[model samples]
Target: MKVVIIFNHPYEGSYCNAILKSTLLGLQIANHQVDVIHLDKENFNPVMRSEDLRAFINKNPIDEKVIEFGDRLKDAEHLIFIFPIWWELMPALMKGFIDKVIFPGVAYDYVNASNTKMKPLWDKVKGITVITTMNTPSILYNWIFGNAIQKALLRGTFWKLGYKNRKWISLNRVKMVSPEKRKKWLTNIESNFSKLK
Candidate 1:
C-alpha cells in the first residue's frame, strides 16, 4: 500500500514531529511505500492567487507543487495527516493544501446536473487517518470547539468525497503530559500503524 502523510508543523523538536517519526517507523515495518508531504519544509504557498482561482474554475492547477502533490495522491491507498491543532483548527498551510490540492477535479466531481452531489475521484484511496496534538483536553475541545476538525476535515471534506474509513487520533494536553506518557503514546501509535490494514 502507498501511504501518503501530509505533515505540517514548523518546530523540529515538537511532539508533532515525534508522532510523524513514529508513524514512519510503523509504516516501514509494515513494508508500506511511504511518502511525506512536509508542507512547512516545502514552504507551500497557501494563498490562492488570481491565477489559481482561474485555474480552479477551469479544473486546472497552475502551481507545479500542487500538480506534483495531486499526481502522488493518484496512487495513494492510505492517506495520513499529521499536525498540531492551533486555535482549535489546522494550520493555514494545511488548510491551503486542501483548498488548492484537493480541487474539484482532483478530489471529486459532481454527480448530478445540480452539482449537489459529489463523487470521489480517488479510486485507490480507501482510508484517511488524522493524527493531531493539542494543548486542550479532548473533551473540552469537543465540547467547546464542537470538534471542528472532525466536522470540517473528516466529515466535511473526505466523507463528502465518498471515503468512509475516516479515523482521528488526537493526543491532547501535550504540554501537561509527562515525557513518559508521550513516549507511551508514540509506542502505541507505532504498534497500531504497523498492523494497519
Candidate 2:
C-alpha cells in the first residue's frame, strides 16, 4: 500500500519524532512505500483569511503546498496521521494543514455525487491510521472529550471520505512518563507498522 504519514511536531528530539521514525522504519521493513510529510517544515499556515471565509461555499483549496499535499492524498491508498495531542485536538499547524488542503470539492464532491448533497473524495484510499500522543491520561480524554480528536478526524473526515479499517493508535501520558516507557510506546507503534505491512 502507498502510505502517507503527515506529522506536525516541531522538535526533532521530541518523543513525537521517535514515534514517527519508528512508524516509517516499520513500514519500510514491511515493504510498504511510504512518504513523510512534516507540516511544520512545510511552514503550513492554519489561519484562514477573510477571502477564504467568503469563498467557503466553493471550498476550493488554493494554496500551492496544499495542492501538492492534496495530490498525494489523491494518489495514496493509505493515510497515517502522526502527531501529538494539544488540548485534545491536533496542533494549530496540523489543523491549518487540513483546512488549507482538504477542501470540500477537492477532498469530496457535492455536485453529481452519489448522495447529491455529499460526495466522498478519498474512496481511492483503502485504509487510515492515526498515531497520536497525549499528555493526559487515556481514560480522561475518552471520557471528557469522548475521543473528540479521533471521532473528528477518523469518523468525520476519513470515514466520510470512504476510508476503511481505520485505527486510532494512541500513546498516552507521555508528559509524565519515564524514558523507558516512552521508548516502549514508540516501539509499540513500530510494531503496529510492521503489522500493517
The C-alpha RMSD in Å for every predicted model, in order, reads 1.0, 2.3
TM-scores of all models?
0.97, 0.88
Candidate 1 has its poorest 10 consecutive residues by lDDT at 104-113
Question: Which candidate has the highest TM-score of all?
Answer: 1
- Top candidate when judged by lDDT against the true structure: 1
Sequence-dependent TM-score of model 2? 0.88
Q: lDDT by residue for model 1 over 40-125, one digit each (tens)? A: 98868998999999998787889888888988888999999999999999999999999999887887788998888888777799
Residue runs of model 1 more than 4 Å from their true location after superposition: none
- Report residue 110 deviation for candidate 2 (angstroms): 2.0
What is the C-alpha lDDT profile of model 2 across 168-195, one tens digit per residue? 8888888898988888877877887888
- Once fitted onto the true fold, the runs of candidate 2 whose alpha carbons sit more than 4 angstroms away are 54-56, 111-117
Q: What is the lDDT of residue 143 in candidate 2?
A: 92
Local distance difference test values of all predictions, in order? 0.92, 0.79
